[model samples]
Target: MNKRLFLSVFFLCGLILSSNAQEALFGGQNITSPEVHEDGSVTFRLFAPEADVVQVTGDFLPSVKIETQMGPMDGPGKADLTKDDKGVWSFKSEPLPSELYGYSFIIDGFKTTDPNNPFLIRDVASVTNIFIVGNGQADLYRTQDVPHGTVTRRWYDSPGLGMDRRITIYTPPGYETSKDDYPVLYLLHGAGGDEEAWISLGRTAQILDNLIAEKKVKPMIVVMPNGNVIQDAAPGEGNKGYYKPQFMVPKTMDGTYEGAFEDIIKFVESNYQVKANKENRAIAGLSMGGYHSLHISRYYPNTFDYVGLFSAAIMAREDATGKVYSDFDQTLKTQMDNGYKLYWIAIGKTDFLYDANKEYRSKLDSMGMEYNYVESEGGHIWRNWRVYLTQFTPMLFQ
Candidate 1:
């Protein structure tokens, strides 16, 4: 054959082979897992052909009793998935409520997220696929067609802690354009959570956006500080580099965090256009964050006019060593005497800390300290915290 003809034939054969390779690699493999139907029923699918047994676990299913060091609590339920002839395993759940749910697939004793689902969130070390059933409380968590806010990850100097820590701040809509000073809500996260927890798992930005748009709550600045004193920020976001997150970290409830809370306050007041006075300032948190909020609010005594504790760890540990943990009764009494606009506490009935909260409330009652108490229906979970945020913010700075 001629040289020109041979080269042309060789190029054409290469093109044909490349086309076949592309077809074999990615042809006809479009999957839609966790399809939410109109009736709120969800169908989860996993294309695991080599799996002998597959099960789907999520909060949407019936819960099972789980025993932990704290107590017996309800845990996510699991259901077996049926394998089809095409080697795809799937399970259709009953009509779920209009809320957010997390799920993972258990294939032959191995747990994995839904590969086809793009939406997922990491809570500490464990990550799971997430989805929302719209038209209810979750709608507030969803980004709606309304004026949006700006979320920024900023660093601040914590003088007491001797390090520059990171915080997640959410400036409300029209913040950039308006010259008005906004109220600030110091929203905190639970243990094992850092600056990113409220923004990612709690959906703080979305909730604020929807609530402010509907005029349900005041347009305020949300400052979410890293509750973990051991780390400067969330995993991989700080100079600590990537490390496995744990549910309990050192110095979490030891009052050093509460003592250094002023650093965060100083940074926000100096940087953002916020109302720095006590009346416009609010502090709230969930779990360990709630514990920090309670201590910090009392320790400062006159800094925050509004305080909220959602599923908060109300007990002060005997081993907790710090000035923040010292003189709890005196500081709390001083705070009560200082006269705050709102002191709100919310907890789920099944939460391990429910009795603690109740005992704390009884203490407040004996001391004649007025606080708004809200009891919810679930255990120690994010759903109740989100609900508490929705209910608590509206009562602030009114």
Candidate 2:
């Protein structure tokens, strides 16, 4: 063979071999990085020949320290990965409880989603890979064979805020065909959450669907409204059709969110064929949303007959402002006198807001009010929130 031809052939062969070697690192044909076993143990795999080190961080593991607005918050713990001669890193986790978990790969100190897993959840500003283990609580988060509801990213006029806003709405299976009017659940999200938080992270639709299918709860419409006072919608959704400049503002500059609550109620009542009375209306929220639910209920006692606060950040009237609001006690007494179908409060024992929840419960006790209290295991995480929703929805509209 000619000398030049021989050199060209050698270079082409080397390139092909390198390509094949790269492909082999991903386990050739079998691409199951997270192989969940029958016993609920999970094995994770990654192919990073050039990486110096790799680790897995998830809720199933111990708390991994991550920076947050409130200084540094401990996220799920980290598990070191062992590398093999094939340039593949792997780790097998202990049997995790049956529930949905969010995890990410820490490749050389930087957080990244699993390249092998396509199931990812977007939370606040970051994204993480997710996996489910066994049945039980995990089954509630999964999409079952029961009737499903329709979730819509809808726009509504917010005259109070002077801008059109977006909200997530869930209409049950027969909402369109049947002429029957349904009760409405105005569900709110946490401080950093948007309208999509509940449907994506909380699994509101699945919980309601399963409960309604089992006849444990009546069919109802769930409205997830954006509670941010300034931002009209979630990130990347505004007048520009993308993230607007004011999206990251410290707080809503227009007005207080409590004052704007009526806009949402009016929109739902006017648009949907829902029972437009206090008896058929319910309001619930988590974290910051819990605070909103508390204030909204107090501000307009005649608007909601059912109120739920999950991991609520309830504050004493003095703690809320410099002094107590004059009408606060009267409003509470009036609401109790009018009679509420259900005033439920649920919180995890380890939650950061647990103490505050206790304080609020004490106040309720002093007022001689009737409310249901639920204390579960775990902290202020999505797992408890999902469980609270499952427990709360079933007790509604009875």
Among these predictions, the greatest TM-score belongs to 1
TM-score of each prediction: 0.94, 0.87
How far residue 262's Cα lies from its native spot in candidate 2, in Å, is: 1.0
Task: Please report, as a residue range, the 10-residue window in candidate 1 with the lowest summed lDDT.
Answer: 22-31
lDDT of 1 by residue, 1-398 (tens): 99999999999999999988875564334567889999999998888789999999988998889886567988899999999999989899998888989999999999998878768999988899999999788999999999999999998989889998889999999999999999999999997888999999999999999999999999999999998888888899989799899888888888888888899999999999998899999999999989989999999999999999999998778888677878889999999999999999999888989888999999999999999989989898888888899999999899
Cα distance off (Å), candidate 2, residue 149? 1.1
Name the runs in model 2 displaced over 4 angstroms. 1-30, 64-68, 71-74, 240-249, 252-255, 316-326
Q: Return model 2's CA RMSD, one decimal.
A: 5.2
Clashing pairs in 2: 62-77, 63-77, 64-76, 230-252, 236-243
Assess each prediction's global lDDT (C-alpha) against the native.
0.91, 0.83
Tens digits of per-residue lDDT, candidate 2, 1-398, equal 99999999999999999989977664453457788998899999988889999999889987655665644544688899999998889999988899999989999999998878878877777788988885788887878898888898889998978999999999998888889999999999887788889999998898888888888889999999988867778878765456433223454212267778899999999999899999899999998788878878877878899999999877643424411233777878887888889999999876778888998889889999999999997777898888889888888888
